[model samples]
Target: MSKGVITVTDAEFETEVLTTDLPVLVYFWASWCGPCRLMSPLINLAATKYSDRLKVVKMEIDPNPLTVKQYQVEGVPALRLIKDNALLASSEGVIGKDKLLSFLDEHLNSN
Candidate 1:
């Protein structure tokens, strides 16, 4: 497991993300989604690449419908950056690792 990445469940979302002191990048996914599988490694890389500044976690939407609906996650492979209990950024679909890192860098750098 990456130092900054963890597999979070609905039960842990509140404490692991919304209440945490560090900025969080949440990967919203589902087992049956193809793109979710494709994006997993990149998410892990982001976890490592930005380990110092960010806490990255993957939340499976299927088993965690409450989180899914609360976040209004209509699709898989969705990434949301939250801090101070507010959403700071988000992206959808499977993007290249570079682009994904750029997205996170922009927000992480600015914050």
Candidate 2:
């Protein structure tokens, strides 16, 4: 866990994410993925920028197979916006900073 971002595991997923009061941005990534590494800073920036309104978390796919399977994550660097235990939006791959922020704003603004 770093600043606004919390690293979650299979055991903690339900309690930390599904049960949270705010909308959660679940960042699904793998250590070996280049894009995952490249998107790290952007993810951190999002966590800090949206700290007041969003709960950001990172889950490594290799160590958290149960959650990965549950989320149906087919690739590293995947993002899932969840609120009230429901999936609101999903994006895979490196979508850059502008797109990432807009993605959040688009869905979050409505709710």
Candidate 3:
């Protein structure tokens, strides 16, 4: 419902994330993952800062096994950057806001 950080479901992954006109940040996280919790706020900040250029979506890996399998996610707190229905890059572990922004910036400008 929020313009910034969106909560995505497996049913909506194809239409909402892969087919989106804007670049998408798909954060794969679990409620029990400590690093995922830590990175959430920074992700929210990014969602707010890059609202126009990006869409940040969070998927709970525990509940979304199909997406986890589709993305080949080996661990929690992973992020997949998708644009134009293709995966550009993925990040594992918790990264700072600057690093996250820099990563997004690199990919967003690649096209």
Candidate 4:
């Protein structure tokens, strides 16, 4: 629940995710989505744990129509991994904290 994860939008996508030096984990969610609410806390914790190597960001798909279309995001609680302005991986649905941490560890270390 610290400010480790950044909230991103269409306006900030380029500067925040595309230009970031570190790998980016974009958590696409919506306020009304129950799974989003359930997954957010774990995502926040993962953000704090991996703050050094990865930058976690949240985007409300409803608010970021351009980004959603650009990224082809089709569902809530989706995780998109990006590096150097290119999307590396994307996963949908809610996952446990351990799985998320492992995912971060695998991708952040591989890049």
TM-score of every prediction relative to native? 0.94, 0.96, 0.94, 0.94
Using TM-score as the measure, which candidate wins?
2
Better of 3 and 4 by lDDT: 3
lDDT of model 2 at position 16: 91
Query: What are the per-residue Cα lDDT tens digits for candidate 4 across 1-39?
Result: 234888988999999899988888999999999999999
Clashes of each: 0, 0, 0, 0
Better of 1 and 2 by lDDT: 2
Q: How would you encode candidate 1's per-residue C-alpha lDDT over 13-91 as one tens digit per residue?
A: 9999999888999999988999888999898888888888889998988888898888888788999899999999888
Model 1 per-residue lDDT at 48: 89
lDDT agreement with native, every candidate: 0.89, 0.93, 0.89, 0.88
Which pairs in model 2 have colliding backbones? none
Model 3 off-target regions past 4 Å?
Answer: none
Q: How good is model 1 by TM-score?
A: 0.94
In terms of lDDT, the poorest run of 10 residues in model 3 is: 1-10
| Models, CA RMSD each | 1.5, 1.7, 1.5, 1.9
In terms of lDDT, model 1 sits at: 0.89
